[model samples]
Target: MSWLGVQNLGSRKFTCGHCGNIVASSAGYTRNGSNQRIYICSHCGQPTHFDVNYQYPDIAPGNDVQHLPEDIEGLYKEARNCVAASSYTGSVLISRKLLMNIAVREGAEEGKPFIYYVTYLADKGYVPPNGRGWVDHIRKKGNEATHEIASMSKSDAEELIAFLEMLMKFIYEFPNKIPC
Candidate 1:
């Protein structure tokens, strides 16, 4: 079997979502006749499956954000995986948690209300001034997901992820990349 012209009969490149490692994958076909191939990451032993004809099955696209603390990075990656799996509500919640994680990492105290973290980040200049609007949007949407019966759409989740990515880049990536 082959996907994206990479043979599934042998070792292939794969990114493990659990540990965020890009390494060779051990491949195997499921016994069921559905033609699904399971690829296990050699480094972390996490398994991901792809249909025989599915293309672009990569879990980790690329690491564009730099200098993120490990915990924050893990949350962001898990949020991305939730987005990929079409779990929009899950993605939004994860993004919300990522926001709180950022706030705490930047020295906000834990155990406060969720909005407290949001306000702290904005007040302390962790997030850009104009970006506070969407930061609140993420918080509101995440509340809906957690407290109400509302379900998040793909577009909404993607927008939140985009905003979160920008905030990460601004707070962690860009500053670290600039010459001191």
Candidate 2:
């Protein structure tokens, strides 16, 4: 799996998966002819392994979503934790609820159908111009995640999370940045 750090030996500064800090490694090793290396964190004494192959553990928390309502913020963090725990489907399902929650927080009537929230966002000019496709993709994937008997891939979960970040920033962050 991919690990964050320089490719050289000796002390390397990498993100410690345990402490979530970028710290120097006290020690590390890579086998001969193997692109994988395991480094011990100086900060936490825990080991973080990096491979030039697949990405296994997504240890990093998802990007912060600024200005979200407290409950929605919690859901966003939970979805991120699902990825760290390798629970892709859970992340996707949570994103579905988040889509609705964001709408309700924006003043859409509660208890309406799921599609109503999505449409409400669009009709109210919340979804950015030409950004309807991203919203639709989240909707379609959320539906598939619910109806289909399949697990979501890491990519699927990550893509949706990225979209949510953008949508939230557009709605909450950017506006808050402007001088009132």
TM-score list, all predictions? 0.68, 0.78
**Best prediction by TM-score:** 2
Give per-residue CA lDDT, model 1, range 1-180, as digits (tens): 334333455776655556666777655445344566777667766666766645233343334578989999999988877766767789889889999999999999999999999999999998787878988998999999999998998777788888888899999998888799
lDDT of 2 at 53: 41
TM-score of 1: 0.68
